[model samples]
Target chain A: MEKIYTRPSYIREGATSGFCPGCMHSTVHKLVGEVLDELGIVNKTVTVWGVGCCILGAGYTTHDSFGSPHGRACAVASAYKRTNPDEIVYTYQGDGDLASIGIAETIYAANRGENFTVIFINNSTYGMTGGQMAPTTLVGQKATTAPFGRDPKQHGYPVHVCELLATLKAPYYLERVTCLDAPNVLKAKKAIKKAFQNQIDGKGFSLVEIMSNCPTNWGMAPLETLEFMKENTLKEFPLGVYRDKDAE
Target chain B: MEKRFMKGAEAIAEAAVRAGCRFFAGYPITPQNEIPEYFARRMPEVGGVFLQGESEVASINMVNGAAFGGTRSMTSSSSCGISLKAEGVSQAATDHLPIVVCSVMRGGPGVGPITGSQQDYWQATKAHGNGGYKLLVFTPESVQEAVDMTYHAWDYAEKYRNPVMILIDGVIGVMMEPIELPDMVSDEFIAQNKAAKKAAYAPGPREDGRKEKHPINVSDGGPMGRNHADWMKYEGWKENETDVEFYQTDDAELIIAAYGISARIAKSAIGILRSEGYKVGLIRPKRVYPFPTKAFADLCPKKIKGILDVEMSMPPQLAEDVDAATKGAIPMEYCLTSYGVIMNRDDIVAKAKEMLNK
Candidate 1:
């Protein structure tokens, strides 16, 4: 008789997500939808989805969405925000899509101080293509491409996206949070909401990188994936606010 | 408007702005760099946006995003840069977004040269991307036609909800010519068009109780149904969008086929041949994709002795289209110069004379 839980209006009703079990992309999607709803920008929001795992993101939300080519989401979002400055624009991308092929686009958009938010989901390995070594793969992490454990000499070191972006003067905010546990997920939600708020205030280039988990790709159970992220991945990519001009 | 001298690259950029294009995203490349340079100065004055993208791949994707937001958007690059944009252009076509791409052609086969060349004819007409989708390829022969084609390209793009390309060569891109620009589009008109497009196609529910549809999103039905629907739109384009320019094809012993800068040279050659008592004609395709198949088919093989395809590529590219259109009934010859060399009028005239003698 009483309604305990109702689907968010921005989320597609009776639709199941295509993410793998224990994948953090679905959770991030829900957080984005919730933030859009709370800020009352659902109608005027346009989200660009990168080519990897987030290509189908438009189907999950009710807002206007565009699917960008591989590693080009930030560039697309930059133009979208500039053309329609009053509307809210954001991009959902993974480490492989952002740090590997799209590194130049990512850096330039931040350098130009384009007014948009980027929701970056960084798992150690490439989840969509069956656990290949990503740009953010840990030093000793085992992946399909790095079967002998990632050797820094051969594969290079992991990219610290937040710290790298912090060196630039323009970005209004840059934070790295995780969704491994309930407390961390709450912190991540807060960081996301603040990023969106910065855009509403006309601050330029806000990015919140979420350290996510890929249980299926990591060859671990859902709970074990959380432990692996905290014990190993967090050491390389520490969770903290790497840059926040507003705080200064 | 008074006729003013302007470069072809600058004219196209001015024409796009006059056509209510509110967004321009492009990268710097030889022969077409003036296009982005012009936009960088003009966009802010008109309350529009101009962004020099990091690469051509990013530029096309940026244009796609801007178009999705209900703004008339465009991007420009040279041949090598256009190759980088092919993937994004294909995605824009599949997503049914309206964006204009101006490719100022240069030498190809791996950044061969920066000078003018028509080697990109096949790349523009036959295979723009991996997808089987075809773009409305407009070949402009002069600075005036470049302005005219670009001014109207946005309308055609929005009408069909497809990508349109203005294919020109470096000769036309860098050459200065006197042209009258089109009437300026007012801010109110741009706002009205953007609002109308958003109402018709923007995702989610509109005030008119119409729901926005995503034809490319496979979650609706599947990619097969969506692809079939997109192909139907392409079929409609074939019926109404084909355009060509005919010059003295009525009583001709030989016909010359060309487009873009090559067509300009062919016209000059035709003048010489006409004075020399040769009954030679020319067929220039204005729209290369819905290619002038009907124009080629209408040529009477009985009266027409042979067709000479003039281009700036080693092995002729447009000749292949002519071969298909004529069904191998008419004999075809080639007059070409590869490695970014512009076709000379004298060379085309000599080639036409030789073909006629044979």
Candidate 2:
């Protein structure tokens, strides 16, 4: 009997994941674990988990991990990787953590070319804080804070982090992917692996922004959230490899 | 030990490196700017890292990260900047991460002034951030003391597995003085320090053959258990870690209580008062968080006529601690300056005389 599918070796056996039902955070966590296992760097990898839904990964993943205060994961990862350059370090951050409260740390860490991977989950809402209007929350999109809809006049605009970071000369790699479907999930995995591999190679500041869905926060069924991602989230966030210095 | 002439801020930076701090992240701020400036030039020479963070908030978080990575780490900032670092400092305290933070304080109720002031005594010794956590705060009174405190700071930090603070006023930060510097820890010692921490917690395989345990820092289980343990640790510090100096205090008529630069000024006043046949003395708390309550409790009520609280903080920050230590049994007088006003030795002497006459 050939075992074709199984849990990644990095994820602990019988560990209970704390993410909500139909949450892509678990999917993304699985991808990170798979990447760590494939690279054989699980033992040497240090994970910095940001506050919000991202912290749930600490339960499911078996790694030397620390939970940083909300939104400061990049700043934390910067020093972690710098001090232990021989080891691998990465941060799992949500849109609220990465784009809103932690934007300065995120931008500065990228600008400094800190050799680490940042796994950014853009779920278009503050999943952990009950769906507030995040910086990545789309205009005309409804959130708890924007009960009617996000108004450009009131909330300004949804920030495109990949585009914002592309302007920086220091970043070695930047890609925006999604876990909307099976095929896209595979692509997302590839991007995440490359981000981690870049750190292994001493490449500076690679980010893989995963455009995901929040079924619980978006107030939709699991299947309806996928449709939401395709119609609204994907249109605002647009999936692609935004910047690759190697390719350039 | 070798004698060296150095500025207070630079001495602190060099001392941390000598104590095996291999990673430093800091922002440019007044009075303490020499710290990061020294590290920027020195860290590279020692095979260490000096990162200028975008903000004070980021700098402290970076120190937190480097500490978690099993490296000796430090960060320095002034009063306003320390306010920004409160969040990261609180987080580091909660996790019991060993790191050093130097607050060379300037005046501030809000960016009040850049000159020397003892305004942050409350912030440093009391609530630096949230959760009502306490750091092992060291209030060094001179360049030599600052260097000595910074040198052994990491030992105390690692010993208790908690963040340690070196709180000096801006006067000590910029003042030049002759100091005896400690020998740098050897590279092997540094490596051993790191290896020990890595084995204990740095995100990977445990040295012993067992599953990776969740770092007590962020574990969700046993909130009551964790809080009780922290409460016990703080209580233990009160018993074992209080550091104070009794200068001419025995059988004195009037005793002055102060810390850091204010203590330096107050000591000179004590000297002046003693020469004039006034039985005045000084009580200096080397570690302010423990507040040296026992020092006050031990004073003979029959011999002590009054105690003067001298500080550069206008509203008398350290006085609260002093008052609690004496339980208002001893009548107290104040000679204070605020908003970056330097305390004068003459003013302290005058206040001591006025209190003794009354």
Q: Pick the candidate with the highest TM-score.
A: 2
Which digits, one per residue and each the tens of the lDDT, describe model 2 over residues B1-358?
9899999999999999999999999999898999999999999999999999999999999999888877999999999999999998998878878989999889989987999999999899888899878899999999999999999999999988889999999999999999999999999999999988766655644534325545534444486777778788899999999999999887689999999998998888888899999998899999998778989987777789988999999899999998888888888889999999999999998989998888
Regions of model 1 farther than 4 Å from truth: A1-7, B204-215, B218-221
| Candidate 1 local lDDT, A171-228, one digit each (tens) | 8899999887789889999999999999999988999999998888889998998888
Clashes by residue pair, model 2: A64-B203
Residue pairs clashing, model 1: none
DockQ of 2: 0.63
Docking class of 1: medium
Angstrom error of the Cα, residue B308, model 2: value is 0.8
lDDT of 1 by residue, B125-172 (tens): 788898788899999999999999999998999998889999999999
